[model samples]
Target: VVYQRIGNIPGVRSASIVSGRNFFSGSGSSYGLGFVLLDSFEERDADSLSSEAITQKMFMRTAGIADAKIIFFTPPSVPGFGASDGFEVRLLDRTARDIRDLDQVATEFSGVLSQRPEISYANNSFSTTFPQLMMEVNIPKAKEAGVPVSDILSAMQGYIGGFYAADFSRFGKQFRVFVQSKPEDREEADDLNSIFVRNTQGEMAPISEFVSLERTYGPQTIGRFNLFNNVTLNGGAAPGYSSGDAIRAIQEEAEKLPADYDIAFSGITREEIASAGQAGIIFALSILFVYFFLAAQYESYVLPLAVLLSLPIGVAGAYASISLMGLENNIYFQIALIMLLGLLAKNAILIVEFARQRRQHGLSITEAAVEGARVRLRPILMTSFAFILGLLPLALANGVGAVGNRSIGTGAVGGLLVGTVIGVFVIPVLFIVFQYLQEKVSSKPAVIHSNETKPNV
Candidate 1:
């Protein structure tokens, strides 16, 4: 039924259903799986035919399914990390309590996440309603019957669940054998009465007197994580939010869970959380590297601030543009930010380097600042506009890899546009302030040449 329904979805090119497990064999308890192949980009040109849109349609179409909990998810963009995109959170039972209790707590945790605005969906496959059998051994009854408790259990294991009897060597090969009762004799619980076990007296007795059977319910399989029983919740971030935001949201909500329960991230979410602060660190390091290079070039420690301080303006511009464009702060956007930093610093360097040269040649601080801006303005605009125009195709990209291209292009373009337009004015003022400070703190004035004319402002 689900296969046919998903096949009928507008953008689905093909749909297949498989029983027992998915292709990756990741879900041991999953009974059935469905694969949907979407139409090619050229065939599905409408915005409604996008992957998210088709997934939403699938959810709406399958909402009437009461016998099964249907979940739809996109495959992970990067392979070997997980089976699907989004966060994989393991809800751990540290004390190894009853499976039913774990199921109850996990369900409640998923429900709480579902209500969070940052989460699109939160659910787990762990279930405890499957029919199972409960076997009880009467230890006292076995002792009274002159039979050992281990003997009865060994008999049951051998007859119902099968046991490794022995290994024999034949024709230079080893053969292992298992023992189990005949299918007809093990058809029902009452059949156990016919299986006999020998007591210490060498007399045979039926095992029914020493064992009891009752129908119960439990999960078909249980999984452990970090050596504790765990239930995994698979979910994605809501629209307009990044995976980082979803992770933080889950962490905040997890604090409200019982002390015995803990949450651990796996796959992409784990990688994201593990490297959460790396971007800021990388940015700081990149700036420090540039600052040191500038210090060496100018042979002064205080002069690099004029170039480094102008970077925040470009960073602010990049962030403001993405927010206005309804884009998230993802890896591609951050990459653009690093590139933006280099470009903006290059523009600042042109003005500051020129202003320092004029100061050494006998120009006043204010005159040198004005002269530097006027001399470097044309080349800065020319280069900045050329770079921005070159990225226009990427900013308006379509088809494959469009999202990443757009992120990089849009961020770079926005940052450089704002930085170049405003930076020409700000760089000179920064140079004047930092230059005055550097001159005041120095022990001697720069070697001024009286033969050179003063810089014209």
Candidate 2:
């Protein structure tokens, strides 16, 4: 039914459903429909995209479904990794000892996510509910009848495997067992019930008469993370929505959760959170490294300060470009920013280092600063444009990792061009200001050379 309904949708080239029997093979406990989208499918205003959107919107309309999910898949399966392009919401039950209450809470949370328009296919991990027949040992009754509970269990194991009776010596090995039952006769549950067990009276009694089987629905598998039972709510972002926006929506819905329920994200969403935390550390480390390196190269702390001043403009330009391109401030974007930090520092270094050399050569402060900026302009532009052009292919390329490629390429282009253009004017002023400070703090006079006529910068 699921496959047929999804197959009916316009963009779906084909839809195949895997049953719980096949899907929940002990290690995993989830079943879903895999969709193959048409080649012509496009996310914006296309027939395939429209069809997929409508299908997900109306998914809950199906009868007898607790939760449903739809996501894109392209394979080269990675071990110990989830196979989802969409976000996965894990509901952790702290107080619940078993899956009973945990599953109920999971279902309720799934319902909340399903109601949100920004997310699609909000499904609980406990999707397959199968009837399990539990067997209880009637210990008191067995004692009264003079039949031990072990005897009853032994009888059951015998049906599956002949009960061990005694050891017989043969070929230097001892083995002994006797069992009576045809394979065909014990093929079904009814056949097992028909088998007899010996009571204290030494009389055969029907197995069904001693054991009671009650049918109840239970999850086929239990998933645990950090020793707490977990149920995942899986889904993809809606059209025109970023994964971050979808996650924020999920966080909003999490407010209504019961006290025992804790939330955790998985897959790319979890990686994103981890990356964001590390980004701050990476940024700090990059700045410290650049500042100290410049300090060492110039052999003075004050001149390095001037080099650092040019960094903000380049970083700002990078961010502005990303915003204009509608790219999220994801890990890829942050990584690009870190890389551009170096490039921006390089541009400032060229100007500041050149001007400091001119100052040492007995030029006036203005002449040195002007000469520094004017001379290095071509080299800075040349190198920056060369790099920008090199990244152009990455920005324009399509397919896997294209988003990340473009994010880095476009950011580099913006940061290099905008920062260099602005830094040319700004660095000279910063150089003069910082140089005056250097002159004031040190005992050296500003005029380092003899009475030579000043040449035009």
Candidate 3:
């Protein structure tokens, strides 16, 4: 029913209901596993027809299914990092609560999280709805009847759980044998009365006399994390929000959980948290390396500042362009920023290096600066414009990997455009200021002649 309904949704290319869990199913049972494929970018060209928008529609349309919990998420940007893109949280129960209580808490947590503005949806697969049979052993009675506790357990295991009996080798193959009662023989609670175990005296004793059975409800499987029972909640960020925002929102709301309850991240969320803020450190290191390299080339520690200071103009333009285009500051964008940093620095170097040479040749700082800008203008424009034109296809990329391509291309183009145009004007002025300061600091005080000084003394 869900497959049919979701398939009918506009922009959904197809919807499939898979019977078993596959590699990409994440960390849970395969029950209710469904996959949806959306139309290609060409078909869904409008904001209203986007994947997020279509997913929202599906959510609303399927909200009427009260018997099953359905969650929709994009595939993880990087495979093996997680089951899906967004946040993977494990709600830990450190107090050793009953399975039913755990289910209640998980449901409540999901409900609370769903209300948060940052989260698009939050749901857990941990359920206690499967019918179960609970059994209690009467150890003393079994011992008195000469029917050992192991014998009783063996009888039940063989009849209900199916026992592994033996293995046999065939024509280049091996097979294991299992012992179990007929399906009908083990279908009801009363079947326990029919089960019999051998006593020590070689007598047959009914196992029901040494055990009790009761109907119950519990999950088919339980999960553990950090040595404690846990329920996993899978969710994604709301529209206009990033995964980082979703993670922060989850952490804030987790504080409201009861004592002994905690939250931990897994898969991509763990990776995201671990890698957070690393970009800034890396960018700083890149700048440091460039500074030292420039210092070595010019043999002046002070002159590097003139080149580094002009970098922000390019970086700022990169970020502004991406933001205006509705792209995130993702890895590709960061990569572009780094590349732009190098290109911008190179442009500045062309002007600064030339200006410094002119200054050494006896020209005034202002004259040297103006001449540098004039001489380097043609090459700077030609190289910068050529690079920008080369990235045009990527900025307007379509189909597979388009988002990443656009991110890299748009950022590089925007940064170079701003850097080359404004940087051409700014670099010379910066060189003039820093070069003047460099000369002043390096100059020594004038000395009087020794012949005149000796007579005065």
Candidate 4:
């Protein structure tokens, strides 16, 4: 309604509601399995390994393996897969009993993406892609070397990963006590072996003696949506062009690659959610402000209703303006409609308040209305024209924020132009009707006075 009102302004060229684009599979929740091309493995070597062999090795070395393949397939339209850029391998595992356990593995897997430069953004289903490995030794493993599990666990925990104990006050500041091995030692297998685990007999034993330490890839730390692994590559678009256009271009480029891989864009939902939330907030605030203003001005609840009746006339003008001006129904125009309510009601208040005062003076309904309109007409016109003239400059301004400002200014000016003219004429007619009803209700005789006659003396 607001857009229509402002659109009719003479200088408004075009107005529209613009929003960000959502790609086919850009959302983090989308599912799919993607294969990462390992530089260490040659194409011929990867192809030579049977799918079963690959699956078994991955399962034994890592955790569960879903599907394994050599060269991934893409849609028919995409070009060469065999010689295309190396791909990142991803698998979906949503049915695990503990989702967080699986998420831990997925988080660790994301680390692999940062290790490679050729790969782009690796999307995942798991909410937390970082994984932390925690190890608890079996009593049997500790006892075999005559060591207490607690002693070994404490020493390893402190030396390997840093154990935080308590804070120490130093130089008027508190510093935490964190004990851990240096970075280089933590990364070496030989250094890890040097860790000493005390035996129950009070003898120090090498960590490698009884407990087997295997550094295997953590569980599927990241999650996949719909049981599919998805990836997205962020690239630049032409200046002044929309993201949608860039996505379509990228999609076309993707088609030129081999059809062995499945790729898509999926960021639309986020954009929609943001736009809806913003619009909803503005709409809610606008309504609340209008109600508050009306309630405060007229002490009687019924008088506010009469003022609100003038709103439809303003709304009708707004609609006509938008249609005539060719603007979109957007947030800026909505704000204009809100402003129009106040302007329209201002005019109505002038007429209604005047008529009300005259009625209080014991004037008849028709006499009160005509006299009110005659007295208020000049002031209403003057105020309305003054607002319109002030807004004209804003509507004509140019540059960075000019378009948005003009949209609002133009909408309000158009509505005010129409509303002020109609309000003056319509409010008087409405006041007359309402005043008559009020007077009739208040002037009724009391039942106890029916037969009583009192002389003037």
Candidate 5:
């Protein structure tokens, strides 16, 4: 209703409303109850399917239509403690057609409101109505026996909730001194009555005389996180809309709500943080290793500098891919770009290393440069294809954590594909330039003659 009202205002494009079970704080039972009140079933359809069709499909899939309604709750909120006087639970055998039916039943008592239309009425009270036995012991009766209320309460607490006696210190560690009755003994009401509490006069009194017990159903405390009864509102944006844009719009709408309400960005946001952190660390290490490998492979630091120059081409391709794909340049993609640097440089290293070897063998720099790329082309292409194919499934994955996986996979593939293509050509050019400088400054080429050959003075 809030969304609908807001959407009807000027400049508003569209609005959707949704509600669901309060799973976070409800009874911890697996089959606890809850419901969702949507403005319209059609408007709130998750897959754009009609409510009746969705219901029918769910019933058919479960093979028990009658059992399906058993889990449904009608009025979302039931009476909790100190609020049960005017309320009564009504079981509905027939489905409610409109909001009036819900309101009529809900307002039968004062201060009662219909449950949000979105929740299942039948399932709403399972957690809230768990059977509990409440007892109030007569303190006056215990006083006649010279027993104090504190002693009785202490005895009960010790037996039911356990008491910490002292801490045992051993070696540099401290362990708790826990005391409690056995579980089986604690479960019996008779066991509770048998607990003895000492009074101010040092007289022992059994708990039974001081307290009365009653069994009834009631709700436990309702907890709130940042107040407005937090709940997960699950839905997707319309077709042709980006998830990020849709989420941003929803967040903006939520922010306009009263300050008492709080909404967290969970699910994808949580996964992105973890995956991005891991990917970043891995990428950083990979780059460091690659740098070391290159430095060790080439004895001349100047040659490694020429090879490292090809890294920027790969970064450009990675950033372009994320931008074109409409993906945020997030941690996963950043890490993937880092990984791409190594893979990108591998091709450059092959061509550059081979050219350097040829140059040292007394071949002219241009001839070595041309021959190195031609010789390494097949290996570079083969390796690039292998990496791309290997990442294809990851790039397309939609399962849990797939968003981060796809980000990394796509970024790496894009960078590697572009880098490999560029490196094959550009590294050779760089090698020629560096070799030209080496030739200009050197008086003699470092010839790799046979080990047995002697040099003339």
Candidate 6:
């Protein structure tokens, strides 16, 4: 019905809605709905609303739903980890209370979950209204009728749940027979009473005569997480919110949760928390290797220091750019920083290497520095400008994981701009300083031809 209404909206070529179970067939995905667009969202005029505004408006316009929230499932994972895409909180079932009380607690926590302005689509994994018929077998009555409890259960299964009868082959293929009652006969809750079992006297006896029946509605499915009954609450960060912010919101809610209730994150959020510093570790290791290689190449510690020290300029740029752009210091930005470590280091190395060569050729320290800076300025500008321009598209991209992409691109640009332009000025000065120290230590006051010495040796 909602889809039908949405389809009527102008510029909406088609609207599709898919539930998690319908799509995943109970595989790995959770319970939710996926709304898709068949045509690009079009704004009819300047006053026309944005897609998000229109979606929220239409959702509110559709009258009937008691509670409605517009939530965008976090965009699909690149590697396709097969599960519903949403922020999830696996609230492991509480042993401290029964399912009913546990449900009440979950409801309260759900309210807490939705309270965060940064969160949306807070919902539970459990679906109800599964009408269940509970039967209490009268053992004595069944025995007096010569029907065993097992026989009674089998009879009920055959009628209500379908039982395997036998297999028959036709056209060279065998098919299993499923025995069930006529549709009309078992159409209602009272129909189960009419089911019959064979007694010792070989007479058909209605199951109702020896069974007590109770009717109730319950969950359609029971889920266990890590060997404990659990209900997962699914949600995601609001637009323009990062997962880090979402995690904080989740943590705040968790901290206030009852001691008996435990919460664990799964999917993307789990990976984020678990691999928190792994990216930094990778970045640090990259720099370590870079330094090791540079040291081997220079065969002098002081020259390598000059090159590595110049990286601070680029690092400063990355930090400043992301902060100014309101981007997170996330994995993408960190990865870009590692790349910058190499990039800026190379810029520094170029100047340092040239200046050292000049010094080796007997040029004065300041002269060597000024000459190297003069020579490398043009090449530095060309390559860094090219790299910065190349990143423009990435920094401006908008869509799934666009946040990370923009962070990476923006950080790279900022770092490159600083490292190349300013580095042309700074690296040579660093080389001159470190090189002067090197020459001072190396040129050691001529062992005065040992004129005053070594006669004792």
Maximum-lDDT candidate: 1
- RMSD of model 4 against the true structure: 19.1
RMSD of 3: 6.1
Report the lDDT tens digits of candidate 1 across residue range 1-457: 8976788889899888877675322544446788788888888778798787898789888889888878889888788787788889999999999889999999999999989999988867778987778889888889988999888888888998798989999999999999998889899988987999999999999999988888998886788889999998998888788888898899999999998999999888888888879999999999999999999998889989999999888889988888887778999999999999999999999999998888887788889889999999999999999999999998887778777898998999999999999999899999999888888788534657775568769
TM-score of 2: 0.74
Model 4 agreement with the true structure over 18-91: per-residue lDDT tens digits: 12211222222222333322222223243334322333333343222333111222222113321122222333
The ten-residue window of minimal lDDT in model 1 covers 22-31
Model 4 misplaced stretches (Cα beyond 4 Å): 1-136, 165-174, 188-190, 213-304, 312-344, 356-371, 381-421, 436-457
**All models: lDDT?**
0.88, 0.73, 0.86, 0.55, 0.58, 0.72
TM-score of each candidate structure, all chains considered together: 0.82, 0.74, 0.85, 0.43, 0.45, 0.79
The global Cα lDDT (0 to 1) of model 2 is: 0.73
Which is the better candidate, 2 or 4, if ranked by TM-score?
A: 2
Q: 288-361 in candidate 6: lDDT tens per residue?
A: 88778877887766668888888889889888888888787777888899888888877777787787666666
TM-score of 3: 0.85
What TM-score does candidate 4 get on C-alpha atoms? 0.43
Native RMSD of candidate 2 (Å): 6.7
* Candidate 3 ranges beyond 4 A from true positions: 18-30, 37-50, 97-104, 128-130, 163-185, 193-195, 201-206, 444-457
Rank order by TM-score, top first?
Answer: 3, 1, 6, 2, 5, 4
Candidate 3 lDDT over 1-457, as tens digits, reads 7876788777899877865453333433436577788898898877787777898988888899987667787889888877887789999999998878888989999899999998999878778986777899998888888888877787888888798999999998999999999999988877878988888999887788888987887786788889999998889888766778889999999999989799999998998889988999999999999999999998888889999999999999998898888777778999999999999999999999988877776677899899999999999999999999999999988767888999999999998998888998999889988887887888721333444445645
Output the lDDT of residue 127, model 4: 48
lDDT by residue for model 2 (1-457), tens: 6655556554556655554433212333344444445434233345335444555534643544545443443331233345556676688888766677787777878787877888865766574365566777777877787777888888887775576677789899877767757789866668766778898889877776667767777877777877777886667767556778889999998888887788998766787666656777888888888889988987777878898888999989988997887666666777788888888888888998899888987787899999999999999999988999998987665545666888888788888888988999999999999888988888544444655768769
Candidate 1 to native Cα RMSD, angstroms: 5.0
